[model samples]
Target: MKFWQRLFTAFLQRFHLMRFFGRNRSFKELHQSSYAQEISKNLSKRLLNASRTQTNDLLKQFDTHLTGLTEEQAHTQQMTVGLNEVTHEKPLTWWQHLWYCYRNPFNILLSLLALIAFFTDDLTGSTIISVMVILSTLLRYWQEAKSNQAADALKAMVSNTATVLRHQVSAEDLELMHERYGIDTKNQTTHQFEIPIQYLVPGDVILLSAGDMIPADCRILSAKDLFVSQAAMTGESMPVEKFPLQKNLEETSALELDNIVFMGTNIVSGSAQAVVLSTGIQTYFGALAHQCYGY
Candidate 1:
């Protein structure tokens, strides 16, 4: 029994290692020859390479490190990177993408009726149908135009990337990374004497921000007077003042706890690094991107 238990434990440990750190990851599959080689791939090459070689190197390092991710981690990384770059094509001066939705069918049907009336010499009925078709066509055009505008507004609010300290192991380095590396460190803690946020469980730190709704439930680990209105999640009317992270006490509810912040709450003020606890449909946003897109 003891031998079986030991062997089972070892097997579980090996799977855990591969599932998280991916210590056995084969870098050979992750590394590309060089950025220059990748640049020749196509159009985004310009936007991709517009940054300095040093910037490209940083991105390269990120990708290489991403190689240590489990299958799920790799998918999330691909989703968040450069999400703001717009690639949709613009329509002609007067026509929009949705314009065809309104114009095509009505015009075609009315044109056929008009042609049939012309052959039969029934000018009055043909004229009335023609007018009706024109009115409907115009209405459809206007409807599509308004829909496009609203969608654009929503897209404008979306955030593509969050600036966070990718490596923060101690409060000392946490402070330094913010000061020097341009990394934000508003929410943080020391766990087992090292910064706890750095030890975030694999495949769980990401939460949607920017225009996207928050992706999960979380607490503020580093709050610099940050405020969040969790009305969507909690039905509060005004934005709540975010407090410093604190240990949970029996008397403290999730909302009253100053140190903790829930997912789906907007970042109302200042800046922060939230410690994500739950995500996806489990979060207040209640929705997550179901499909993955990568370039």
Candidate 2:
């Protein structure tokens, strides 16, 4: 692409960040604000506190089907809700990071002093300060960018992975998590895999088994001796047995409910079927991480 055209395209894409007083805010802030508006109503408030039956009813209320959301519905929700990821600070370009270092208060003062000394024909103070500021600016950018890149790479490499059930052909298909990766049968059936945890959306049925990680905050639909080790998140070393709530329990709280499993918790024994209610930073565990990190 031509330089000017590419520049114009970049400018327009970043136009939403334009603000008064020469300030800039990330485009992520706009998305977050939009998401906040989505959860302001009673619907979201009830989901966090409602019991299993009530939560299922809410899902049915949104759609007529009992087989979970159709592919179209899942896609729509994916676009509406976005990826299941913790919110990250938007990365700054190299120039922005360098400019940030250059604008440091002490460095700015030293730079001005250096300029004054230079014009006065005294080489010692100005020469030393100027060299220091330039080298420091370069070093600061290098350190900051390198650290940011390494953190991001490590985070991406090690983030928890999950398996989820999307709208599928049959019960048998749902049982085979790695549908595509597995060998084909004489039935001539093509296969696929349960999507990554990050791809999970509301209303998807998650098949849980022993040693499987709970991808998103979910409500138990049916369980068979489902004992989960929530120690990593809940700090309770003992495994907690989770089951479906017979009656709609409300006053206690979702976290206290035996029917709900959350992200970052693992299933220690038995298996269950669940529906994802929240994912990404909207999850309870994600919020806990954000708070622990002093967000």
Candidate 3:
């Protein structure tokens, strides 16, 4: 019995059929592993090179179609992979902000001078320097806190919503649609809806038009003269044209792949339909954000 079990496991591994046998690691398990970061980076790289893959193959990997993902599937994916939002650094507390303000070279020099003045019995000079340091630190802290609040508000307004094709079925028609089509009722029809970008997940099919920000890293399914401004990522002033992958193309950098669009970029002209490849901290933009936050 032991020998047979070992043989069966070996056969499944050799055939890459462990997933079918329910032996594959769950998202939660992988996420909690020590190699999570390495796995995430590899997944991002794979999606970035998706331009070299066929559209059907890419769709199969994501378990989605051009018609988009069903509401239930999207919800499940969200729960598994987490939200399509970047993690931000914790805001500095008042004391921390004050410390930062006082830690500047100018403030340090002033503090040292004030201390020296006190030791030299120069009461008036020390008092003036101490007042100057306090006033400067308080003023700087207030200005920085206000600026941070304004920046947060602007960011909230900017990333509000995204247009995606979601398949939703009424509860009453669920059985009828399932019986008639002999398919998951959610796949029967797709409807365009503007949903909050934070609710977005991998496998979503999104529509892009001029002025709309790309919600997540996605592979282009079909495009029509699609032009995108990659200034946010590449600092390129000129908008680059993008299109569907008609053939396998080798590229040195993921940015050079015209078939994949990244989050944080916006459409400059024309339109496109793309399936989400990565989201949240797993996306290109999110990775950059993670680095910037020193995570």
Candidate 4:
């Protein structure tokens, strides 16, 4: 019975019928599906409680430590969760924008009137109406195109890199380090490296300083006088202070948790180390971006 079930599932998947059956969705399809929003909500629930959990427990939940994840572990997680980058909706092409402008009801009515005038041999009226429609459509298209260009320019100004602690294990010296410390060598061999923010994965220990952007949703492992600006996420003009979780502090909202910081916020003062909790569309900022820009 199990064999037959597997065979039937394979058959449905092979012909791309699994989506109709609500099964066997590919990673991309799963994220793009209607259920994506629900999945993000579930993740949000989990992260909200993370600040109440102890530092050691939180690290254990993600299978990481203050020393950070091993290179192999990072790669595996990256494969499962995808790159830590927000995806924007594709902008309309020039022709598509022109078509959109021409599709306006007023423009359509004017076009129809121009055609009728031509058929009636009113050359002067037809020419004037045709010119009006062309000018209006062209003007709207140009304005929209220029606005898109400005948006693209602003997007380019966002930070694209982050500093993360990653463990490097050399097979040749692994045995020596383990023998000397009587512990795992991987956890003792972490080094801070600047990497592209898109390469970040959950469990990465991020290093933050004043003027640095928060690369992902993360829980503060430790901090010193850390002040972050939440103006990007919340309209609050004042910078909020953050610290490591000392006890199970209760909060009405995730943003109220002093131990957890969200993606896209900026650090205004001090330094800290944090572990990435979620990335890409699973983040609070990412979900908002998805809603605004679409998948």
Quote each prediction's TM-score. 0.38, 0.62, 0.69, 0.68
Which regions of candidate 2 are displaced past 4 Å? 1-45, 48-59, 62-68, 100-116, 153-160, 168-192, 229-238, 246-251, 285-295
Kindly list the per-residue Cα lDDT of model 2 for residues 100-211, writing each as its tens digit: 7687688999999999999999899889999999999999888988898899899877645444444445545444433532433335343223456676777776688998
* Candidate 4 segments exceeding 4 Å error: 1-44, 104-106, 124-128, 135-159, 169-190, 246-248, 291-295
> For each candidate, C-alpha RMSD in Å?
20.4, 10.0, 15.6, 12.3
Global lDDT scores for all candidate models: 0.44, 0.66, 0.77, 0.78
Clashing pairs in 4: none
* Tens-place lDDT digits, model 3, residues 1-295: 9999999989866544454565434333444455545644675468656767788888888888778887678778988998888986556667766776777789999999999999999999999999999999999988998899999899866646787786654665455434532335454444676677887888899999999999899889888989999887776789999989834365545776878898999999999999998899888777666544334
Error of 2 at 275 (Å): 0.8
Q: Give the 10-residue window scoring lowest on summed lDDT in candidate 4.
A: 23-32
Error of 3 at 158 (Å): 3.5
